[model samples]
Target: MGSRFVNLLARSCNGGPRHFSLHRMNPANLFHPTRSAVPAVQPLADAPLPPPALSFGWPGKKGELAWMNFMAFGRTGNNFLAVDQIGRTFFYDTDSRSLRTGMPMMCKPIMDPISIAVGDSLYVMSGNPGPSPGKHCFQALIHGRLPASDTNDWSWYSLQPPPPFVNDIPRFHEDEVKSSCGDVPAPYEIGAYTVVGESQIWVSTAGAGTYSYDTVSGAWSKVGNWSLPFRGRAEYIPEHNLWFGFTPNNLQLCTSDLTASSEVRPPVLQNMWTDVVRPKNWTLRDASLVPLGSGKVCIARFFVTHSDNFEDMSAYKKRENFAVLEGVEVLKAGWAHLRMVKHKSERYVFGRDLVIPL
Candidate 1:
């Protein structure tokens, strides 16, 4: 059976080695059909919690000089890439928690970029060449698998510039430059990207509009206005054919249709939000919502809080909580059916970069 992994980056509070861990989960075991039929806030620590399959050092440091700034990340099958502050990208085998040999990306790294894996390929958009000469609004596709041994290598090839709708947005002045290929428009800073079915990738920029790229024909089109509270961070729940967005205080839903509406139906960008049950005395840092095998959803949240509210931010401690919600229709989620199933204490000062297999 296929498994899903949650990847997180963190470090010890006492200034120890930074650690990256991948928690493995088999969605089939995440829920029970015969549990309480009504909605109620239950303690997650009472249920069985899945453990980490792989944990290791965070890439980027060689000596005593590493600063550990998270740059970007993407996953292709069991392999995941972690980009460091200096623009170096390292690949790891999630099954073994081992690093694979490979050269870093050809361009300099910036901030949040649209990164995703489709089949055997990893596609990265924007966040390259670090906006010096110009904002590099380009896309690159890394093909092939990890080298058979330490001596072989994979290939990174740049794709054509994103379509007009992407480059045409007024976020930045369009720069026309020639790469090794030919004349192309610079890449725009992409806030998030997600796969839409089998043939398209949906992108939300740092501001305003949302766009989609056709994988088969290599074309781009404006999909909808990005007015939702959360942009790229929203996760798709296939069972309901809807997108789920999260905040510390609420959970929101919207149609997964990637098209702007004209006359027939309302636009999917308009979202309906609902309050969720959170543990007392916990402040959320990051969270992820992934589909559990049979019409169930697992919501994983990273939280932090201080022994005393008057203390400095550095005094806060971190923990993770997991909850399961089942059988509630998305449109009619007036009262949540969520329950806490697991909890883990994190020794790190903090955590970020919640990556789950798509």
Candidate 2:
């Protein structure tokens, strides 16, 4: 096993839990099921109410605060996917919300990703990609599959998609192929996915450009050569029989069959929410893909920061008088002023190691 897989081995497998198997775990805790999708869990009354299975719980670490953005990882069990820090994808079992067994598929490091999916005997699409500082450089639109039962029997391939164009239509509804979302201040990471069914491939990219590699042909095309809007990332809701975006602030999106439309596909969004995790002063970085159960997703995001003036005018005034008497006299005293509140009681932030969900 690779180091990444090995390190998470005990927690993800062996000593911990295997893929979320309906036949294995508590059946009463499932979320729900999508069309042609699997059920993630059976509704359990005593368990913590999974906030609608609509919240996409995005996880991150800032200083000492481990920020978690959540959405209902809906029960239909086919849309959710996770791309670890490294470029690894783990398909989650819908009924169990656990990763599929024996799959640590060899893929590139997706810097940040949000969603993924597979169809037509191929990994049609894998994640939501974009141009945030937190997103990945997204060099290769690679594709391949391992022996269903053999990890060692894996195959890999690379791709070369086209460059990006401008979308200047303005506004989410009137969005052109070149409008820039204020959300992506700078290219951070690209980690999210959307489905372009008409093309028979799932396109992953925002602003950076569209990419759909034919698993069978091993060819990469910038078919939908428009912008991957920052307002939303790709998501397939099996239950709704539709595709959506996992943007922050509860915003849901609809995708065009990039394959069917002759012109650039128009992206539709639901004002239900928007990306709440806005950066202070960040840019596009990178992204990656992760497979939870029903399908997989790419988390494309960038590192963000905030700043404020902290100079003490009072101290400076005193220093002016001292300096007037002698150049050696100096004055400087200040400290950060900000209020922080934590919701979780656990002092330790990395609860996965200690909590052991599976």
Candidate 3:
């Protein structure tokens, strides 16, 4: 995310010391095909595991834990903002390893809401409200800005809803024609979103194309009839001048020049790498890419195991719930080539608890 580089030492999976390139490159040639090569997956090194910096479970009641959905957004540095299904908010600081309560949201419970943090403000958008048969279920936009001081109160305010996807609209009988705009259903869940520059949030939805929301003016405008090439949140790195994120279908690590995307052309994948080789029985639940500054990154992936053969409910209950953390560094070779060096891999079990990186 930042352009500055730090001198960090890490060992590659092959047990050799790997140095991350600190040389800065021209932003204009960042996406040129001749400037880079396909990255190879190097094995991870076996190293001493570090002590856990923080550990906590669902912040909601035990009864609500089973059904409650949790989402987290990195506010700044080590500070993270978390929200549960019941609109409760929690703030966690990784640097201090402290967790504190925050002002609750004003909106109703939204399942698996999409969230992003830009500057001092955090935003939450479309999500499934609930299971209402024959009725639409989607939430509108709400955002909260960080208080300037400890004595100031924190709060969430409503914003204009995003434009709806044409295909996501529910079909109605001819006799049940609606009369007003309120009759139309809410928009579908967003496919992906990322902060552009320092003030604009770019959101992409299937069939609805792409749109940009200006944080300063609180205005939304159509960008193009195309969706973002990546899924979920894409991290923009100034060092390489590229946005890195997971591919939509397979979740492979990929990079693209998001700013180069236009009304007629979608963002093209400049480079891609298979960071993890998952097994057939291991189903991926969620994945996140965390930037550790410089050229270092941590890939966190949550998975659940399943049986190949038919099993009883009791046998299925015994399936393992675990997560894998992979450390990697993007290095510049010579003047044009780029390489991804695998550093370490660690796995942890969390039983039935859902784990996500902030």
Candidate 4:
């Protein structure tokens, strides 16, 4: 058994409370399922070069804040959109290596939102109305476009959230759950899923299930059950035909065919949340998937640990840890043909994939 699964079992066995949070840590990291349409031209033996290390500039600026609740990165051509916790949006022209200020999202006091870039346009799903406590804006999907020719002019556009999705939210709403249980209920959790060549963005609502938004047709439809449940994020390996979800507990996989099939086709592969990655003695902080231009992916998991002896709780440190996993068909269980590349670093910022023009 993988150490992560064993560790979780050990904690439960020892009567340590297992709590699930939608946030990163409590479930701190939020991930959007995305695909890079770039094809793998070479085999594993002649793996293409890894992407350049991301340059965020200063330590405490917009993109570098350690404590930001939610942040997402997306790029189209040479333009990179870095949206941080404070609703501030900055555009980076990768070609020029220059940063420019962009319009801020109108929705203030936003909860967890999903940001994605399609072509030269950026889409943000802000699920609530602004500045109101507990006011769920279940029907709003915000959009922004990076200038193609007009560099000086760009703003955010708002679109109605898929009607069926908005209407259905009231059914499994948190307020009803709390009232029935005679206590506060866990917050509603939302996660986004998408692919590079596909226009649909699949979103999962906690008490509810999975739903997909068609960017091309501008419609939403109720999908099936979520394949894997995690607090952090998910990544799609285009070459492997797999989607991987990262959480504090374990790493899981959702096959591409499984995601598209309305009914579970292959019994073994149906709802197959395969455990692929696991690390011992570390609390999973956040993770991002980077495609290494091969049929494999580099999974960077941020882990934090305190002194084992419990001498002082404040003596905690974060580490940058990563591993590369090659895609393979393992019929039974557990990840096969996985390789761990040792990396040691103290930097613990959120990691993400950025495709730049070569």
Winning model by TM-score: 3
Query: Could you tell me the TM-score of candidate 3?
Result: 0.70
> Once superposed on the true structure, which residue ranges of model 4 sit more than 4 Å away at CA?
1-79, 83-86, 102-111, 126-153, 162-166, 169-187, 225-233, 247-249, 252-256, 263-280, 308-358
- Model 1, 1-358: lDDT tens digits are 1125433444433355566555554443434444443335433333343455545565555474443333223432445666665666666666576776465563655344556555456666653232332334444545545556554355555455534444344444435443222323334444445676666777654443566777667787766665333534565555445556553134343334434343333335444434355547555545555544334455555555434555655444343333332222233344333223332212222233233322
Model 2 whole-model lDDT (C-alpha atoms): 0.29
Off by over 4 Å in 3: 1-77, 102-104, 128-151, 161-187, 312-315, 333-337
Model 2 is weakest, by summed lDDT over 10 consecutive residues, at 320-329
Alpha-carbon TM-score of each model against the true structure: 0.63, 0.36, 0.70, 0.54
Cα lDDT tens digits, model 2, 144-205, are: 44547443332323233321221211123323233233343223223344555433344434
lDDT of 3 by residue, 174-273 (tens): 4553332333333344667888898888877654678888888878777888889887899887667788889988788888888898899888887788
Error of 1 at 283 (Å): 2.0
The runs of at least 3 residues in candidate 1 whose Cα sits more than 4 Å from the true structure, single-residue gaps closed, are: 25-29, 33-41, 46-52, 55-78, 85-88, 95-98, 103-106, 127-137, 144-153, 162-192, 225-230, 247-256, 259-266, 269-275, 306-308, 311-358
284 in model 2: Cα distance from truth in Å? 21
Greater-lDDT candidate between 1 and 3 = 3
What order do candidates take by lDDT, descending?
3, 1, 4, 2
The model with the greater TM-score, 1 or 4, is 1
Between 2 and 4, whose lDDT is larger? 4
